[model samples]
Target: MATAINVQSSCSEAEWKARQRLAACYRIFAYLGWDEMIFNHITLKVPGEDDAFLINPYGLHFSEVTASTLVKIDIDGNTLDGSTYPVNKAGFTQHSLFHRELPDVHAIIHTHTTATMAVSSVEGGLQPINFYAAAIVPRLAYHKFEGITVHDDEGPRFLASLGKKRMMLLENHGPVVMGRTLEQAFLNHWVLQRACEIQMQTLAMGKPVMIGQEVIDKHMANLSQASIDPVQQGVPEFDAMVRLVDREDTSWRE
Candidate 1:
């Protein structure tokens, strides 16, 4: 059996902080019911380290994850930091490609929520039919599902599909959200999840009214102009959720 390792003592201050934040993200996902029983992944690039990143240890539920338990691995999927738990190969296959290619994308989230998967499997993908959808529709990208994401051959195709977009819906699968920071990635996923949920509900009702392109553009413009500090994107919202999770269980910070 593999024993637990003291990760904080061995890592730098910045990396330790990254580990804590990533662990909290897992707990937040569990709290939001976005976790898929240890199947999905959320990865963050290790601070001050090139070609290295962090991921949840396989076999543990998201709620069981803690700062000390996240496995540090390189872009090529080799586990560093001497973590005993194995890395999820499928998670590595998908997340590594983006981390290697996109220098600006420090955080990546992949989930199999019903609403997101439903939106992905839909014919037209996400439409600008509601406020949440209208805000993100123009930035959303789509990639055809290529079965489970374990194969190395699919890497290039995934990159090509994403291009310069930060969010992508995998046809017949789920969603992948990337961000310059972890908080931004979480916020993006939140918005996308809401949009899909509302779309599913609206479709069940009847033919839904779509938002006008001009209105969506205007809304996006207004949002851009409303930011008090672009660099602090998603920090406030993510911190609020962190506080909620802390109230529930601070074990994730262990």
Candidate 2:
């Protein structure tokens, strides 16, 4: 196993920081019960490197992901760090498309949690009945399911479906979120997962009270105001989660 000192010595300072954050995010996902065994993926772009990004080693469980174990690869799917672990083909297929096309997107998270998948499979998709759902509805995009998403041809169609939205429901599949920062990406996934869980519970009770579009717009406006500070947008929340993860296990920093 590679130690923190060894890994940090081998990478640039910015890249090392990105690796720690991404590794912490994987453990945070596990802590939140958002991981699906060794599947699903969260990727972050290598700072100052246009075509390079970091992804989890193919067979490692989320909890086992450490900074030193992350595999660096270019958008073309070739490993650049010379790690023994292979990159997941499906993960590369999905994440590479967004990273290559969107210059602003520095982080991407894809999940197959039960609530998210359930919402995705529904004909109506996520309803704006809950706080989280209402906020997401205004920006959410949906892509039709095309088998397993490994083929190279599906990339263009997925990008087309994503359009200008940062959050998307892979129809009958799961949710894929893109962010300009890793903090933003984690927060996006957190809210999206909560929205789906609330929607599921609310629907099971009976008829749901959907929020009016005008009210939703107002709510979103308020949220925008609250998030006016770009530097602090998702920082506090992400830092808090990272703290929680560290309390349990700090090996992710390695």
Candidate 3:
């Protein structure tokens, strides 16, 4: 364990790479027009810590984010890295609820994308409609609104409602996903955002809803098999997305 700590502490290069990629994610989401200012958050669990995470500083938009700019904070919202930029205490509430409760969750992304919010506002919540819709997920949680999640008292509901699920539709809000790795979380967010977009656009046509669980499961399995690591597949195009975001802004590297 001590050797591991030394490696983590001494390995500035590796840490820098992690931060750069994470920062790129923030900027890419911002460019995708998914950000709702500081209202939503995307958090990554620290490499080896159990009760710690990295979240956005309150004022910066995702486009301006960089690896170093991300604030390191404990589950209680305490800043561990001496960052002057205050981490969003209220925003941390929902993220903390997940990171603290789920050990498998290394990355958590919360978004306020249009279609997702629209789907969340509906009476039944996300009804899987197409192949994309079928990927909505299994065991999705629907948590009732208790106003903005800032207070610690709200943790129980957040924890209870999430209850070992990857995705949660914040009733009248949007969705949050817990990923075991940064890339997996990113892939999940991509699918979910697309699902919400498709649901919203198609629902406007007044089409029938997809209620078949078997269909959803089938396509979901396909999507899972299709899922692979960006770097592992030699997908230079994956970094292209990061570059696209970097071209827009590089403040995230600070």
- Measured by TM-score, the strongest candidate is 1
lDDT (0-100) at residue 188 of candidate 1?
91
lDDT on C-alpha atoms for all candidate structures: 0.93, 0.91, 0.75
lDDT of 2 by residue, 124-203 (tens): 89999999998999899999998998999988888899889999999999999989899988888899999999999999
Which one is best on lDDT? Answer: 1
Candidate 3 collision pairs: 65-252, 66-252, 66-253
TM-score of each: 0.98, 0.97, 0.86
lDDT of 3 by residue, 1-254 (tens): 00101122433565556666677778878788888876688888777678878887778777767676777789988977666787666678888878888888878888888888898899988777765557665757889988887778888878888787888999998888777777667766777778778777888898766658777677678866996663343134346777787676776655
lDDT of 1 by residue, 1-254 (tens): 35568888889999999999999999999999999997899999999887999999998999999999999999988889999999889999999999998999999999999999999998999999999999899999999988999999998899899988989999999999999899989999999999999999999999999899999999999988996565588999999999999998999888
Any idea what lDDT model 1 has?
0.93
Candidate 1's C-alpha runs over 4 A off are none
TM-score of 3: 0.86
